[model samples]
Target: MVSVAYDGDEKTIVRRRFLISGIVQGVGFRPFVFRLACELGLSGWVRNIPAGVEMEVQGTAGALDAFQHAQAHDLPPLAVVTSSVVEDIPSIPERGFTILPSADGEKNIQVAPDSALCGDCLRELFDPADRRYRYPFITCTNCGPRYSIITAIPYDRPRTTMAGFPLCPDCQREYDDPLDRRFHAQPIACPACGPRLRLLDGAAEPVAERDDALTRAVELLRAGQILAVKGIGGYHLAVDACNPEAVRRLRERKKRDEKPFAVMAADLATARRLVVLENMEERLLTGPESPIVIARKAQNCPVSPLVAPANGWLGLMLPYAPIHHLLMRDHFQALVMTSGNVSDEPVAFEDNDALKRLSAIADYFLVHDRPIHIRSDDSVMRVFQGKPLFYRRARGYAPRAVRLPFKMPPLLAVGAELKGAVCLVQGEQAFLSQHIGDLQNSSTCDSFRHTIRHLSGILEITPQIVACDLHPDYLSSVHAAESGLPLTKVQHHHAHLAACMAENGLDGAVIGIIFDGTGLGTDGTIWGGEFLVGGYDGFRRAGNFLPVPLAGGDTAVREPWRMALAWLYRSLGKDAFDLDHPVARHLSDTEKGIFAAMLERGINAPLTSSCGRLFDAAAAVLDVRQAVSYDGQAAIELEALAEGAGVSGTYSFGIADGEPLVIDFTSLFTDLLADHAAGADTAAMAYRFHATVARAAVEACVRIAGQSGLDRVVLSGGVFQNRLLTEMVYTGLLDQGLQIFTHRLVPPNDGGIALGQAAIAGWQRGC
Candidate 1:
C-alpha cells in the first residue's frame, strides 16, 4: 500500500521499515529492537523472520531518526548486522511497540559463533543471591554456547540441543519477558531445569553427579590426575599445569610429544603471570571469541616448563565458561586444556565416544547431559601486525559467514588433506566449517564428511558445484568424485592465492607467494614453495623452489634428515658427505645406499619444490630436529630456535632461468653448510636460514612484479604461519615499495583452503 505522505496535520509522521540480517536471531535482536523503539517513543512491531529481524517504526521524523541511530550504533553485544535495509512505509495507526511471533520466509540468516560467557552472566554465576549461583551453564542472551548447541535455524529453543530441557517457571518467565536479557535466548536455562554435570570413571561408571561432580573432578586435578572435561563444542583433556609429572603423563597418553599445551588461567591477572600479555593479546583472551592466544612466556613463570617444553612461546586463554570459572576459582592457578583426542583424531564430542576413546588418556570424565550438536575444537590464534592470524578457526570463532566481495553461486569446497576444513557458499556469504582437523585417519575423514553435511543441512544449502583439490587420492577429493554433483578441481597453491584474494576483497590478479609442504603440481610434481600470479578466475605459476628429489616421498616429511640428505645430494653431489654434516655422518651405510638409490633412480621419490621440506632440511643440518613427532614439529622448533637467537643475518640465494623461474638455494646450502663446518652457533645459523628465505621471497616478488606488472603480493600457505618469517617477509616486501597482504581473518594454512576453493569454483560455469 502507498503511504499517505501528505495527511492533514500529520506531515511529520513517518513509518520506517527495516530488515536487519546476519546473526540477528538467537542473540536478542528482536528484544533489542523492541526496547529501542519504545525508548524512542515510536510505535512499531518487531519480530523474527527466516532471514533476519524485520520491523516497522511509526513516529515523528525526529523520533524515527533517533531510533535508526540507536539501531545502528547500539547493537546487542553478540549481534552482528551484515546488512541493513531501511525504506519508507505507510504510516500505521499503531499506539505502542509490540513483538510479534516470528514470520518464516527464507533460511538465510547466519548462525552465531559460539561465544564466551559475558560479564553479566559471570556476575550472576558467582553471586550467592542470584538464582544461578555457581551454576555451570548459567547464560543469558549476550553469551554462552551458540553454534555448538544450535541444530537448525531460524534458531529457537525448540531447534537446539537444549530442546529436551523444558524451561522451569523462573526461566519461562524470563523467556517471555520482552525486556529481559533471556528473552528469546535459545540456550536460556536455570539451575533447576538446565543440564547437570557428572563425573565418570575410566569404565564409564558414574562416580559423582551434579554439583558434587565438579568438586570431585577438581580434587582429581589437584592430585595431579588428568580429567576429560566436556566443553561447549567438545571434550578437553585437562590437567594441572603446575604438576610437571602430570603434564608429562598426559602428553605421553595423548601422543602429543613436543607440541605446546594451551593453558587456561582463572582470570586475566593469573594469565599475566604465565605469559607476556599485551593489550591486544589480552583482548583476544577475554574477547567474545576467547581463542587460545600464542604469546611469549614470562620469565620466572610458575607453570611447569613441561607444558611447553623447550619452547619460548605459550598458548594461553581465559576461562570462557562458568564451569571453567568455577574450576579455575577452585584455588588452582592454571590447567592445561588440550583437545581430547589421540593427537591425530577428531575431538570426542559424544559422551559414550569420549569415554571409550579417552579412557586410557583421562583418569576421569567430567561430562554433562547437554549434547554438542556439532564437534568444534578450540580456536587457535596469534596477534601479528595488530590483527588476528588464525592458526585454527573453530568453536567460538567459526561457522560465521565470511562476507564475500561479490555474490556467488551455492557450492562446496572440500579443502585439502591436512588441516582439513570445508566451506559452503550461498549468495555473498561463505560459511566455513570449523577446522575438521588433518584428514589422516578414518575418524577424521568421517568428521570431514559429517561437517559438510551438518553445515549444509543447517544453512539449508545444497551445493550446485563441489570443488576439491587436484590431488586425486585425497579423501576430500575422492568424496567429491563419488558425489553426484558437478566438480571443479582447484590446484593447491592457486587455492591459497584465491583464499587471500577472497578474504581481502581483491578482484584482479595479484602476486601470491604460497609456501607450504606439499600440493600436487599441475605437471604431476609436488609443488609447495610457489610464486603465482592470479585471482579467483585462475593463476599462473610465475616461480617456485628448485625441483629436488623428495627421497621416500611422503616419508621425507616426517624425517628431516632424509630431506637434508636429498638437498645435500642435489647441491654438492656425492661430495656432500665430506662436509662433516651430522645428517650424513649419522646415516649407516645401508641406509645411505637405500636413500642414494631412491634419489638417483626416483624410486618412491618424487620431484618436489615444497618450502616445508626446505625448512625440515635446514633444521636437520643445524641439528635442531632430525625427526618430527607431529606434522609441523621440525618447522615449529626451527622457528622457535631462530626466535631464541638474536641473530639477524641473511644467507645468499639466487634465481635460476626456467619457464617458471626457480628459487635456487644452491648458495644458501653452501653458506649454511659453511656455518655448520666452522662450528658456528646453531641458533644463529637457523635464524640466518630463515632470513635467507625472506630475502629470496622478496627477490622473487620483485622479479615477478616486473613481468606481470602486479604491485600487490599476498603471502599465504602453512609456512607463512611462522610469525618470524611472516614479519620478515612482510617488512621486506613493503621496503621494496610493493603492497603486501597476509592472512588475518582466515588461516594461511590448509584450514583456510576450503574458502579459496569455494571462491574460485563460484566463478566457474553455472556454478
Candidate 2:
C-alpha cells in the first residue's frame, strides 16, 4: 500500500496547537510526548514553555485521535496534566516527531523537586571510561536535584543552583542531543563541574581530600566513631549499629532514647539478613525513591540490635546518592542513619550549623559543598498488604504531590501535635511537607514556618484558608493564626477518620475507630479510643470508651501504676485502693497516701478515655512494666511480650448503658490477683489481657455496625501500630465478612495527620 500521508499535497487541512498546565514541567512530560507521538507515527514537536508545556501535532485523523486518547490516561507516573486545551492553528510541513528546546512561554511554570539518582546514572558512575565515573553527584534527566536546585519558575540551568557551575563542552554536547536522557536535563553536570566533598575532624579542620571523604567516613564508622554526613536533604548522624556502645553513646549525645533509629546497609542481601522482606517490601527497598522504613523485622535480628533495640522492626534504606553508595562499597557492613538533631527539633543541614550543633553527637563530619535550599528528612514507610504506607514523606518522595481522588481548592493544613507534617492542596495535587517533628519547641516551630514559606513560594499558592487541629496548645494552631489566613479547626479524631477515607478513596459515611495515645476531646477532656460516624465534612461521636480518672496529669503516663490506681478506683471504688501489689511496694508510704487522697478528691486529675492509658494500666496489673523508660515503652513491651501466646478468644468487659463495653480493670485486676494466687504466668495474663481487649473492641464495633446500618470499618490512630492488636482486629473483622479499610498510603499514627487535615479542608471547601 502507498504510504498514507494526510499532510501531503493531496490533502492538508488544519493542525491544533495545545498548552498543558499544572505539574507539566520537570517530570519527563516532554519526553513522554515525544515517545507517544513517535509511536503513533504522528508528526509533532513538543517542548517546555514557561507556564507549562506546549505541543503541535500533525497527522492522519486516526493518529491524532490515538494521541489524544493516550494523553488522557497514559501520562507518566508523576505527571499531572491539569488542563489540556487545543487551539486551531495553521498547518505546517509534516515530518517526524521532535522534542525542541524549552522556550519562554507567558504562563507561570513550576518545576519538580530533585529525585533520587536513576539506574543509568549509577551504571555510569561505576564505568571507568565514563567522564562522570566515581563522581559523587552524578545525576541524569530522570533523577537528581530538581526541587532543591531550582531558584524560580521555568526550570533551566540559568535559574538553578547549577547556574554557578557551567557545563563542560562534552556535557553541553549531551544537552544538545535530543535522543539522549541528559538532553534538557537541568541538573546535569560532569566531574569537572559538580559539587565537591571534604572530610573534617571534630575540630572542623580538613582531614581528607574531596574524593576520600567517603572512604574516611567509612573508616571512622568501622572504628565505632560517629560521623555527621551531609545528605541530599539534611545531615545524618551515622555510626555502626552493630557496635552497641557506639549506638548508646550517639543516643546519649543526641538525647534520643528508645525511639528506634533507621539503618542503611550495602545492598538487599545485607538488608535481608537484618529484616524479613516480602515482595512489596523488596520493591520499596530497591525502588527509585528507596525510603528508609518498611517491612517489620524480628526483634532479635543479628546484624544490629541497637538499630531497633526492644522494637521488632528497624527502618532501612538503600544508598540512593553517589556518596552513600561509595560508603557502603567497603569497610562498614551497615550503619545507623538517624536524623542529626537534638531532642524536639529538625535535623541540622548546613556545614557550619552541623559543626556547631552536632559537635557533641558526631565525632567527625563528612561535608559537601552543594547548598541545600530546602531541608528534607528521609521518608519512612511500612508495607501493609502488598503496598507501602508512608510514615514520614520527604527526600526522594516529596514535592511530587499526590493527586486527589477529588479536586480541591487551594488550601494549607497545619497538622496536629507529634509527628507533625504540613500539606498544601491546589486542584488535584497535594504537596505534603517533610517530617516537621513535633510542634512543641521553638526550633521545630521555626523550621515548620521556614519550610512552609519555601514550599509556598515554589508552588506560588496563596491559601484561601488554613486548616488546623482543634487543640489550642498545638504550635501548629498558633502558626495558622500568624499566617493571617482564615482558619478551620478540624476535630482531631475526625481528621483521623477523614485521613482513612482519603487514603482508601472512600466518601461515604462509616464507623471509624480512632484509637491513639491522645487527642483533645470535644468534651473538654482528653479522648482516645473513640468511634466516630461520618465522612470528611463532619463526624458524630458514635461511641467511646468510658472515662476514667487520670491521676497526676501527665505523670500517670510515665508511671503506669498511677493509671492502675485510677483504674482500681473506677472498678472497685475507694475501698479497693490496695497498697499490697508489686507497684505499691515501690512507692513511699507518704507518696501512697498522697496519691490515694488525690484520686479520692479528684485534685487536678482529669478524665480520659484513652486506650493507651488502659494499656498502661494492664501493664501495671500484670507487673510487665510499672514505669516507662520512654513514651509508649510499657505498651510496646507488653505487645512484644504477647508474642507466641495461644489465643482462647472468649473474653468480655462490662457493658455500660449499651455503650462500648467499659473494660473493667478492677475485674482484670482481680483476675490477675487470682492468677498470681494460682501461680499462673504473668506472660499468659498479659497475652490474655491483649486478646481480651481485641475481642471487646470487635464486639463493640459489631454491635455498633448492626445498630447503625453500616458495615465497613476504618481502623486508625497510633495505637494500631501494635502489630498484635492490628492483626487480631484485621483477622476478626475479615472473618466476620465485613469490608475494612486501614491506613496504607499514610500511617495510622499522627504522621498521617496532615493528609487527614487536607482531606477535611477539601471537603469543607467543596473542592
Candidate 3:
C-alpha cells in the first residue's frame, strides 16, 4: 500500500531508467532510492541487478530533475558511485514505488568495506531504554561489518555469516519496515536474538557468561592479565597498556621482542594524551575506516614506555567496534591490542584455533559466538605531508576494488615472497587480498592459498594466465609454475616500476628509481638499488649501485655490523678495519677473521647493491642499532634517530658513463668516516647521509631523463616507506621540473607487486 500526491494542474509524466554502480549493494542504496522516489511523489520501481541498482521512475520533469540531483548528492554514507547512466523511456501507468527482486546479470558492483560504529547506533547502544542497549553487536543500516562477513554477491543475510542468526519478532518487524534504519541491514541484531559472549579459562571451561563475561574480562585486564578477545575479523590479545609488567609479559610470551605494538585508546582525548594528533589524523581516527595511525609519542606519556620501547612514534587506533569501545570506556584508558598469533602465523579467526594457538600466551579468553568467514588484520597508516600513507591495508579498507586503466582479461598474480598478498584481475577491476604475513612460515603460506581460493570463489574468476616473480626459488613463483596454466615471469624491479605506472594510468616509458632490500636481478645477483627506464611492456636497467659482497648472506640483514664491515672493507683496504669505529671495536677477533676469510674465498657471500643494506650499515657505523628484531628495524630506527636534525651538507658519488651506469659511493663512505672521527653528532650525520642518498637519487634520475628523453619519474620499492627520504627525493625532483609519480592506492612495498604483475600480463596479452 502507498500514497501519491497530484497537483491541481495536470502535468505530463516522463520516465527515466537509471543504472548505478560501485558500492551500491549491501549499503542501503535501494532503500535510499525508494525513499527519495516516494518523497518526490514518483511512480515505478527499483531493483538490484548484478551490474548495480536499477531504477525506473515516472514523474514530472521538475520532480525528476530533483530526484536525479538527490541521487548523486544525497547518497547513503557508505555508497560510492563510480558511474551512473540515465536513459529516457516512455511513461508507464504506475501508482506507487516498489522494490523488485534482484535480477541476474553481469557482476560489476563494488563491495563496501567494514565500517566503524556510527553515532546513531552508538546512541541506541548506550541508551537504557533501547532494546539493543549494551549489546555487543549493535548495528544499523548506516554502519556495521560488511566485507569480512560477506561470502557472495547481491549481499543478503543468507549469503553472510549472519545467516545462522534468525531475527526475533521485534527485529523482523523493524527489518520489514521500509522507514526503519534496519530495513535491509543484513547484520542487524539485538540483545534478544544475537551473538553472546563467554569468558573461558585456559582449560576452556566457562567462568562467566553474557554480561558477566565482559565485567570479568575487564577485571582480569586491570589485574595485568592478557586476554584474547574475539573481534569482527579475528582475535586480539589485549592488556592494559599502562601496566608495564603486563606489556612485558605479553611480549615475552608472544615471542615478539622489539616490534612496536598497536594500542587502542578509549577516544580522541585519550589518544591525544599519548600521541600528537592533527586535524587530519583525528578525522582518520574517527572515520569509518578507523585505522592505526603512527603518531609521535608525547613527552612523559601516561602509557608505559615498554609499549613502544625505543620507538619515538606509537601506533594508535581508536576503538572501532562497540565491544572495544565499551571495554575501553568502562575499564581502561588504553589497551595494548596486538594480533593473537604467536609470531609468524596468521591471525587466529576461529574459536578452536584461537584456543589452541593462543593457549600458551593468553591467560583467558573473551569468546563470542559470531563466526568470522574471512580473517582480516587491522589496517596501519601514517600521515606524511598531510597525506595518509598505508603501512598495511586490511579490515576497513580492502576488498574494495581499484579500477584499472583499461579492461583486463581473467588473470591471477601471485605476489612476492615477502609481505605476501595475491591479486585477481577481471574486466576493469583489480581485487587485492588483505596483507598475508611473510610466506616463510608454513601457516602463512597456507593462508595465502586460502585467500586465493576464497577470493576466486567469491569473484567467480577463472584465470587464463598466471603471473609470478622471476625468482625461481620464491614460493609464489613455484606455486605459479605448478598451477597448470599459461604463466608469465616478471622481473622484480620491473614489476615495482610497472605497479606505479599502472596505478597512475601511465602508458609510456618513465624513469624508475626502485630501491629496496633484496630482489633477484635478471643477471643472477641480488638487486635493491636500481634505476631503470620502462613501462608496463618492458624496462632497461639504467643505473645501479656498486656491487659489494654480503659477507654472510642473510646474516648481514640481522646483524648490521656485518654489512658495515663489508662496506668498509670494499671502500678501503684491510687497514680500514683498524679505524676507531664502534662497530669495528665491538666485533670479536674470531668473528672478524671468519668474515674476512669468507669474503676473500667468496664462500656463502653474494654480491648485492641494496640501498636497504647501506642504511643498515650506516646505522651500525653510527652505533644506532647493531641487531634487529624485525624486518626494516635498523632502517626504521635510523629514520627515527634523524627525525628533525637539519643538515645542509651532503656526500658525493661518482656516476661512470656506460650502458648501465655504475653509481660509486666511495667518496661518501670516506667523508662519513672522517666526519665520525671529527666528533659530529650522530643525528646530524644520519640526516646528512639521508640527504646524500636523496641527492644521489635525483642526480641519477636527472641524468637518465636527459639521456632517455623521459621526463616522468616513478619512485617504487620499500625504501620509499621512509617519509623523510621520499619527501626529500620528491621535492628535489620537482625542483628539477620533472613529473614524479609515487604509490597511493597500492603499497610501495612487495605487497603491491602482484597488481603490477597482473597489469603487465594483461598488457602483454594485448588486452
* Order of the predicted models by lDDT, top scorer first: 1, 3, 2
Candidate 2: where are CA atoms >4 Å away? 1-24, 35-41, 49-52, 59-92, 100-114, 296-300, 573-580, 658-666, 765-767
- Model 3's alpha-carbon lDDT is 0.87
Give the per-residue lDDT of model 3 (tens digit) for 590-705.
Answer: 87777777777888889999999989988988888998988899999899888767767787778888878888887777778888999988889889889889998988889998
What lDDT would candidate 2 get against the real structure? Answer: 0.78
Best by TM-score: 1
TM-score of 1: 0.97
On the 0 to 100 scale, the lDDT of residue 301 in model 2 is: 67
Q: Is candidate 2 or candidate 3 better by lDDT?
A: 3
Give stretches of model 3 more than 4 Å off: 1-12
Better of 2 and 3 by TM-score: 3
Candidate 1 per-residue lDDT, tens place, 521-609, comes to: 99999999999998888888899999888888788988999888888888888777556788987788787777777887889888999
- Show where candidate 1 strays beyond 4 Å: 1-11
Candidates ranked, most accurate by TM-score first: 1, 3, 2
C-alpha displacement of 762 in model 1, angstroms?
Answer: 0.8
lDDT of 1: 0.89
TM-score, per-candidate, Cα-based: 0.97, 0.90, 0.97
Clashing pairs in 2: 51-107, 113-147, 114-146, 114-147, 407-767
- Give the Cα lDDT of each candidate: 0.89, 0.78, 0.87
